[model samples]
Target: MEVVSSVRTPLITGGKTVGDVTQDICVRVEAKPPKSWFLAMAISLTFLFVGLYAVFTTAWEGIGVWGLNKTVGWAWDITNFVWWVGIGHAGTLISAILLLFRQKWRMSINRAAEAMTIFAVICALFFPFIHMGRLWLGFYWVMPLPNTFGSLWVNFNSPLLWDVFAISTYFTVSLVFWYIGLIPDFATIRDRAKNKVSAVIYGALSFGWVGSAKDWSRYESVSLILAGLATPLVLSVHTIVSFDFATSIIPGWHTTIFPPYFVSGAVFSGFAMVLTLLLITRKVYKLEDYISVQHIEFMNIIIIVTGSIVGIAYLTELFIAWYSGVPAEQYAFLNRATGPYWWAYATMMTCNVVTPQLFWFKKIRTSLWATFFLSIIVNIGMWFERFVIIVTSLHRDFLPSSWAMFYPTFYDVGDYLFTFGIFFTFFFLFAKFFPVINMAEVKSIIKSTSTSDKALK
Candidate 1:
């Protein structure tokens, strides 16, 4: 009996050989980054600088530079923070949660998603740091040291402190998780590298991986443990983010439904961002053979399911607000639908609630252009969701006297633009430097395809 090597391509597939698929995927890395890449990089960098300038000018001036006032203390800055954090959640969900379920389709797109998570978290971190008004002493919030002159202690009970802890932990864990997965793939690149500079950099990052049996064994074990640890942390981080609102005494913010609602919304929005990136990347890298229509369809199912859950949460909040007869909560919900920001609220409902329902159609879900446009719509809706939640809830609190409308000033808009600038800048850089797809995981999938073919024969 001859033992089949899993690493080899199959002899036949629909009368076409497996070599064709491998050639389609592996050949593109040989080509230089297109002129379009430089164009995108230049554009993203310019936006990034403008964003930075906005942040710096605002920090030097004060929160007064923005449209935020006493009633709506947290406006665009907090909305942008929560939105970016929610966007970060999908990467860990794909890399860690799906891995535990043994979803092999994730292999092709997880790398890019994980990179997106890291960049999104970086964008999220910016708002909180600068929103402090006094950036130099912002570390005082979490330094864990007793204040000598002011007798101030970091409020352990405060949800804001909890957010600090939660966001930092999430960022660190995501970075580690992403880098560990990259090591072996980096080693593969190092082996294939022709230039001394490329070889040295990739070789250093690979941590001298030789692909020994023992090394693979340990690597697999560590990956499993990390995935297990990260799954709960991913769920918890967003829950805690919701707590930043729920734990507040504000009527709209103080709800028990927030944790699950936020998690679902996070996953929904995160998947949208993932779909947006993967759609472009698969085409740019000519990786459709690996990141197939099946993968896109599976992700669409997740988007629909999560989107429906989020829509239900929205309705449930309205029902609870009315049924409870809590005047403040009722007012909050009413104001969202019929208040100064009503247009934003309706936009949220239309984009997040109505648009994603179209994915129930197989034709819509599988069509790349349809999915791409829907992904953009989902992101827009998600942003509006955060805005509605933050602004609507806080803008008009219990006392009618304190009620006021909030709009983003130039500084506030700057904060948002910079956040996008940073996110796209990191993403563009990732595209140029790294293996946007995990070569090892893709190789394994290719090997599995070969085995499935042989078994069929």
Candidate 2:
């Protein structure tokens, strides 16, 4: 017989019952959205329009319109690409890995986190296409197609080519996994939906879920299968992304530690992004009972672990540069800390390294305001970390005569703002339509007497 301890705090607070969980989550879906949602949508649309104009300018006049010197061919584009990709990492980790571990706390946040992974990956994909100058003409070049198709073959040796394969596969798997988890919840909404149109739409999305024993058995099996498939991707996707730099011969780019290092940094930033969005969402949607302080603390603990790993990785990079006794490598890192872009490096260390350490104090980690503020600070630091890694390393060349600093044009900021517009806009819409909390899973947790009995005893 298995024994369970009741010593731990409740994962779902407020003494919520199965019925309470369903009603609370389903009401958000059934009711008309509040005025605040409309106001928020209006602001996001404003940013979206600005971003669209910037993308249009880049596509029309070419990437040459932005500042790119001979020495620094990559600037904000790759930096933001890596940053957004990193932001997407936490969702799969939270959804797949935690699910595999049989962690019950994930029930509340997995829906939004999985949705975040989808949207963030979409935003990350924009850079490489835009970087090609004429995305419409060159976009197909990256497709993992047969050379025999005779549209010609992609350069198999290119790191960009590998990124095309890895990120796309990651996106496809995440989308399916997210949608799969939503089916039963969709069915719930379908049953509760009063309008004919609402019933029809949700019924279709649910794919005829009937809550039968056989249907549930199949659902559990499929979720496990998909979770197993996604678990490796959490580690592999970021590892492959790290290869984009690690496989290079550049002084700062070549490193063996980058795979694990990148993975940890990705989780660090990803969790911060999740917290940033979730904190506001719970308050706005009045989901405090489902997403409680305990949940926030649990997430904060993970942030601490990942943040420390990232901090160690940062120090490891510095140590390797010193211990390797390679002048170019030494100068490369030294330039990052003391060169023209030293401020960026400083910001990265302070935000990613220093701010997260504050979570060591329970008072701060559990405080909603502190968690939200630091989460934003962590993401800002991560963006600067990418910028410092990309621009600082490239700005100083072998010869001082060839060295040049990269400067962003209007498009750089605008393209980034474009992604912000896309992410928040889609997120708000998702919150408005779908059950933000996983209604099916939350009900199961409360309804499962077998699990609750063990804890009760």
On lDDT, the candidate that comes out on top is 2
Q: Cα lDDT for residue 187, model 1?
A: 78
lDDT of 1 by residue, 66-170 (tens): 998899999889888999999999999999999999987778788899999999999998889888889878877566776874557878998888888888999
Candidate 2, residue 73: how far the Cα is off, in Å: 1.1
TM-score of 2: 0.96
CA-lDDT, candidates in order: 0.85, 0.89
After superposition, which runs of candidate 1 have C-alpha atoms over 4 Å from their true positions? Answer: 1-31, 148-151, 450-457
**How do the predictions measure up, each by TM-score?**
0.93, 0.96
- Residue pairs of candidate 2 with colliding backbone atoms: none
Q: Candidate 2 residues 209-307, lDDT tens each?
A: 878999889989999999999989878888988899899888888989989989999999999999999998899889887788988998999999999
For model 2, the stretches where C-alpha displacement exceeds 4 angstroms are: 1-4, 146-151, 447-457
